[model samples]
Target: MGVVDEAARLERAGYPVIHLEKGEPGLDTPAPVKQAAIEALLANKTRYSHSSGLPELRQAVCDYYASQYGVRIDPRRVVVNAGSSACLVEIFLALLSPGDEVVLPDPGYPAYPRFITAARGVPVQAGSAVTGYQHTAELVREHLTPRTKAILINFPNNPTGAVADAAQLAAFAELGPIVVSDEVYHGLEADGCHSRSILEFTDNAVVVGSFSKAYAMTGWRLGYLIVPEHMVTAVTRMHEDLFVGTNTFIQWAAITALGDAATIQRQVREELNTRRDCLLAELPRLGLQLAHQPRGAFYVLVRQWANTGTSAQLAADLLKHAHVAITPGSVFGPSGEGNIRFSLSAPADQIVVAMRRVEKFLVEHPALAPR
Candidate 1:
């Protein structure tokens, strides 16, 4: 059984579940972004944009990178799409040949392989928990083959929350294969650490980013990709055909979201850090071992000493018995075996309330805890 089903089924059965299974931001879209969308709608700005997206919105994306990371690029290189998922689809479709191989980290985002398959490319999975789930430059180099066309990296990663090291990222840039960097959670960093954009090291890289995670714009259906000048034609051509363009009002709104992000970004980052600190300190009391303390993103994958069955079964038992929902690690890849991921995306209050129940469950089932 898929790991996430436990949450949905319980919700359907009206089981009074605490949802921590999804990553949708707990906050509403920021006020400025929302106001911009309203203005656009009232101004009749709801038309199919320039077949790539509004030039201004693309420029906004460029301006954001310059201001935040000191990275500079031509706006023409940005291809706006419905979301980062669509950008990934367009990227794989445009870049991957039928027999080409793309190196992906195991226990990585599940959709990486599926999207590669949809593009008729092979996803070569490689990684180990020994590296805290980040795709080490060494592991990536080991996976390289004559057919290797690209390598995918998701920093401030999902599930594992691992950030890339600058040296390793530079090594990846020096590596010959094309690089696809997913920086969807870029601004939502933890502590004082920051995520690296492949663009910082190589202009040959393809960058995927979105307003979803950082700006609480999940339903906005807006994302953009930065491609090298040589790859721009193919990517924009694919975007024109498959996605047409990102939502017009959303494109306009995201422009404001990028400009007015200072306060909200701080609020979100602090809250995530607070939640991360709370969970790391509390979950261990249940005797669940944190294989690694995640430094960024908002998830902690933990393993219990109990023989509670597979990760899926363990997740099911947690939901059924504790009334809490979490994701099973096996769903990501084999390296995720015996682990469960707790998403800190739930509101702080909800996380506190739910962990209390998880603590109670651990107490009742003494077998689930270590001595």
Candidate 2:
């Protein structure tokens, strides 16, 4: 957030900052989704719906899983929220007692720990760097304790774009703790390979999904949680007490988003793939190392050369000197200290331009360049 603010300040001063920092898609919300919201508003469908979400929207979520993953979900178990972040907060609150532990991936999303801590749960780090940033049940088991209530996993993960397979998901399911799978980036795979949902392996899991990344609906604030039947009541109670309900018209729009999800997600995936390829080809030429090839999602975590200083320092220097904004991986976790994350949220041409600037920046600061 500090980097974002600093980038914004530079933009205000007339600097043409190339934004590789934003996690959102560069695309606008699909026309059909926008039109659906407009239609709902015109029809005066502004009244509050169920706190669990509009019945149709929840049904759409169920249908989505059925169609995409061939998994049957009971609509009664879905809870819509303002965003997936809200779902995370509700899940932690419902599942955690004070000091109960939740195992999270180191080098994972920065907000995961904060959400857990906010619910008075301890966030235990399971080192994923050793597994090339892929969180495996084997690594996570080493961190588990009697106090561990859940294992939080994000595939097509943030910062590091590693995707887990079915065997890994099955292993996580058998780990004797609830698996909270963040599948917000499920459909955004850079390769044409679709990601497997944890539900395919076990019903004893919570899925945090959003239309933000795949549908370009970040500003719409629409997301949903799919909980196990046993957890629905407890999670819904927390949602009802805190959020009451999500926006009525927006939920109506989400039904449309899911209805046309195939077409919409394909478009998003293609664009991200183009951007990803550009980075994969160019970043190495710029003397940066990709610790892991991003298979899903829109980020590439690049390792800085030896003696380039902390990831935070490198990120700040790039923003201040190159006018190219990116996230320092350190903010994600301690395991991310020597890396910086590049978000493929800009156009291919813009990304190319950003790389050129980075190349020049490295040349000016020779110590930052790889030997």
Candidate 3:
């Protein structure tokens, strides 16, 4: 967020900075989704519904899972919140006691630990990037202790973009801790393969899903949690107390989003894949090593071979000199040090422009040349 703020400050100062730092879809909300919201508003569906979410939206979620993943879910187990972040906080609050530990992937989303800590839970880091950013059961088991309450996993991950297969999901399920699966990037795989859900392997997990990434509904601020039957009451109660309910018209639109998710997500995935391919092909030629071949999501974490300073310093320098904004890998976690993350949230042409600027900047500053 600091990088974002700094970029914003520069933009406000009239700098034409090329943005490769944001995590949302570069596209606009689909016409169908926006039209649904407008229709709902015109129909006076603005009144608050159940704190858990609109029943139709919840049912849509169930239907989506059934059709997409072959997983049958009870709508009663769905708890909609402002976003997946809210659902995560509510889950942590409902499940964690003070000092209870939640195992998270190192170089993971920086906010995961903060949320766990806010819920008075200890955040333990497991070195996931060591295995090419895969949060395997073996890695997580090594981090577990008696205090470990849950294992948080994000596939089609944020920075790394590495995804796990069903075998891996089953391995995680067998580990005994409650699996908090962040499936927000579910439909955004680059290889055109749909990522598997934890629910497909076991009913013992909690799924954190969002329309933010796959559906291009980031501004809509809608996400949901598919929890186990036993967890519904506690999680929903916590959500109700904190946020009475999500926007009613938005919920109505979400049902529309689900109804036509395949068409919307296909268009999104194709565009993102094009951008991802552009970065993957270009960055390595600039002497930056991709941390791994990202198979999903819209991020590419690259090792900056020339920089002698921290990733944060390199990122800041890039913003200052190249007029390109990228995230410092160090902010994600220790394992992320010495790298930078480029988000494919900009147009392909703009991303190419940013790379050209980076290449020029590196030339002028030969001290940053690869050793």
Candidate 4:
């Protein structure tokens, strides 16, 4: 957050900054979703609502799962919050205690460790990178300590864009730590790629999702969590304390958004696929190797195969001179130090221009470019 804040400040100061830093969606909120929110407000549905969110929205969420994934979900297991980021913090607070160690994938989401540390727990970095930026149950097992209380899993991951497979997810679930699965980017998968929910493997798992990416509702501040019946009450209390309740009208609107699955799914699938291809094709020419073709999400982790400077320096150089912004992998964790991440969340035309700028910048700055 601090790094991004600083970058944003510099950008506003007349610098020609092209920020590809955050994993934000480049698309606008679908018309149907925006319409629902407007209608809600016009109808005087602005009062404070239940802390756990509207019952109808919760049921709509359940119906969404059954229709989309063929998985049956009970409304009692769902808890809605202001955003998935908030829900993640609530889950960590409820499930962790002082001296407890939580296993998180190195080079994973930048916020996972921040939340874990806020809960007074230690974040144990498991071997996600040793296996190509992906985590397996065996990796979790190797890092397991008597005090290990929970495991954090994000897929299609943030910086690496690594998606988990069924066998790997199931195996991780069997390891006995409460799994906090972040599925915020589930719908943005690439060609021939599909995302699996951790719920399919175990009820012990907690699933966190958002309308921010798939629906292009960044300002709506809407996200939800799915947990077993036993954990719902505790999570609800944690949510209540943190955020008395979320935006009432937005909650009602999200129900409509969830019900109209076909429209939203089709749009996100098309746009993200196009952007992914644009980035994948152009990145190599900028002197970075793909390392892995991003099968899901809008990010790709690349570094100078010829070994230039650290990723942090590369990212700074790109933003300052090239007028393009990307996240340095070191911010994610130690394992990501050599890599930099680009978000395909930008428009295809903008991405093309950004790529051109990066290529030209690298060619000019031979000291920074790989030999």
Candidate 5:
């Protein structure tokens, strides 16, 4: 089984199931963003936009990046899509041939490999969390083959909340291949946490971002991509055929979201930071080993009890017995087999309550703890 089915089956079995499995934002879309979409609908702007994107939204995307990152983005280089996942599909289609190989880090996003396979490209797992989930220049270089086409990076990463610093990013950027940087969790960093822009490192890269995390707009179905000038036409053309541009109404709201991000990000980041601190402090006491203090995003990747068997079985046992639900790290990749990921997107109170039950279960099932 697939990850989604495993989750659905467990949910149907009626566990208390403190859901830490999904990565969606816990908060509702801010009022102004909602209002903007509604107003756009009422204004009859609900028509097909330019296949690349609405010029207005594309410009907003460009302006947002230029002002925030001090990086100049030609509006022509921005391609709006339903989500960054779709953007990934477009890039793969535009760049890779049937036999091309793409390097993706292990314990990385599950969809990366699936998407590459769907696009008829090969996914080469090149990096490991054994080195703190850091994909070094040497490993990336070693993975390079004549067929290698791109390297994918997810910073302030999912399931681990780990962010790559400047030197690490530069190493990948300087590697002679297309770099796809997934920066979806950019603004949701814990206190004093910040992610370096891939734009700052190289021009031979595409940065994928969304309103999902920072603006609490997951269901908004909105994401955009930044491609280098040379690849912009190909990526945009693929999006044109496959996605037909992002929803016009959602684009309107996303523009408003970019404008109002300061107010929304401050409130969301503060809460996520608090939750991260609480979970990090408490999970270890319950006998799980925290691989590290995740400086950004909202996940805690913990080592499963040594003899507790597979990550999937341990996650199943946690849900069935302790009334908690978390993602089995194995779903990400082979290197993730002995770990599980807990999401802090839920409220702190719920996390605390869930931890209590987990602690009790660990005590009763002593074998689930490290020997």
Candidate 6:
């Protein structure tokens, strides 16, 4: 966010900056989705609905999973909200007690720990460094302590796009702690890896999803959560107390947005894969090693930098000099210190140009070269 803010300051000062730090899909919301919202607005659907979500939209989400992945989820288990971040907070508040521990990936979404801490829970780090930057059952078991309350996992993960299959899901299910699965990037696979919901392996898992990435609806602020049958009411109550409800028309629009864009989604994913290919191929030539082949999401967390400077310093210098905004991986966690995350959400042409500028910048400042 600091990098984005700094870039914004430069942009406001008339400097042209290419942003590769944003988490969204960076595509315009689909035409049908926009039309749905407009229809809702014209129909005067602005009044607040249930704090959980519109019943139809919740049902649509269930139907989507059933058809897409054969993950048969009860509609009642789905709790719609403002976004996944909001759902994570509510889940944390409802499930965590002071001193309760949540085991999550180090170099994971930085927000996971913050959410746990917000609920007065202890955020325990399970380093993913040796597990190829993914939270395997081995890593989870290694970090398991008596205080463990939940295990948070994000596949097609941020920064590192590594994903786990059903085997990992089953492994997580066997653990006594509740599994918190962030599936926000569920449909954004750059590779052909099929992502299954934790619900497929464990009923005890809390599955989170969002329209922000798959449907290119970030501005819509629509997200949902699927909890075990018994936890729905508590999750709903906490969300109700905190947010009352989310956008009304947006909820109506999301019903249309869900499963409505197979072609658009495929095209977008293909484009992102192309971008990923470009970066993975070219970045290594620049002396940065990709932590792993990014199979999902639109980020490449480049480590083994040419420069001796810290990731934060590299990020800042690039923003200040090249007007290219990338994320310093240190902000993700201690394990992320030696790396920086580059987002591929920009236009293909712009990404090409930004890479060129980055190459030029590094050529002149040879000291920053990766060894």
Give the TM-scores of the predictions, in the order they appear. Answer: 0.96, 0.98, 0.98, 0.95, 0.95, 0.96
Q: Give lDDT: candidate 3, residue 100.
A: 97
Output the lDDT of residue 290, model 3.
83
Alpha carbon lDDT at 78, candidate 4: 84
What is the C-alpha lDDT profile of model 4 across 72-163, one tens digit per residue? 88887888997898888888888888989999988888788889989898999875567777767788899999999988888888877888
Clashes of each: 0, 0, 0, 2, 0, 6
lDDT of 3 by residue, 1-371 (tens): 87899999999999999999998867999999999999999999999899899999999999999998999999999999888988889889888999999999888898999999999999998976678766689999999899999999999888898899989999999999999999999999987567999999998899999999999999899999999999888887877888999999999999999999999989999999999998888976688888877899999988776545988889888999999999999888888887899999899999899999999988888887653
Model 6 over residues 1-371: C-alpha lDDT tens digits?
88988999999999999999998768888888899899999999999888888889889988988887788888888898878988898888989989999988888888888999999999888877787687788888988888899999899788798888888888988988989999998878976677788888878889889888888888878888899988988887877888888899999888887757567668778888888887777775566778767889888887846545888899998899889999998988888888889899787788878888888878877777634
* Residue 301 in model 2: lDDT: 92
Q: If ranked by lDDT, best first, what sequence of candidates would result?
A: 2, 3, 6, 5, 1, 4
In candidate 2 the C-alpha lDDT for residue 82 amounts to 87
Relative to the unseen true structure, what is the C-alpha lDDT of residue 59 in candidate 4, on a scale of 0 to 100?
91
Error of 5 at 28 (Å): 0.6
Clashing pairs in 4: 18-323, 18-325
Q: Tell me the TM-score of model 6.
A: 0.96
- Which residue pairs overlap in candidate 3's backbone? none
lDDT of 4 at 64: 82
Q: Per-residue lDDT of 188-296 in model 2, one digit per residue for the tens?
A: 9976677999999998899999989999999999888999999877888878888999999999999999999999999999999999999898976887789787899
Please give the lDDT score at residue 354 for candidate 5: 86
Segments of candidate 3 deviating more than 4 angstroms: none
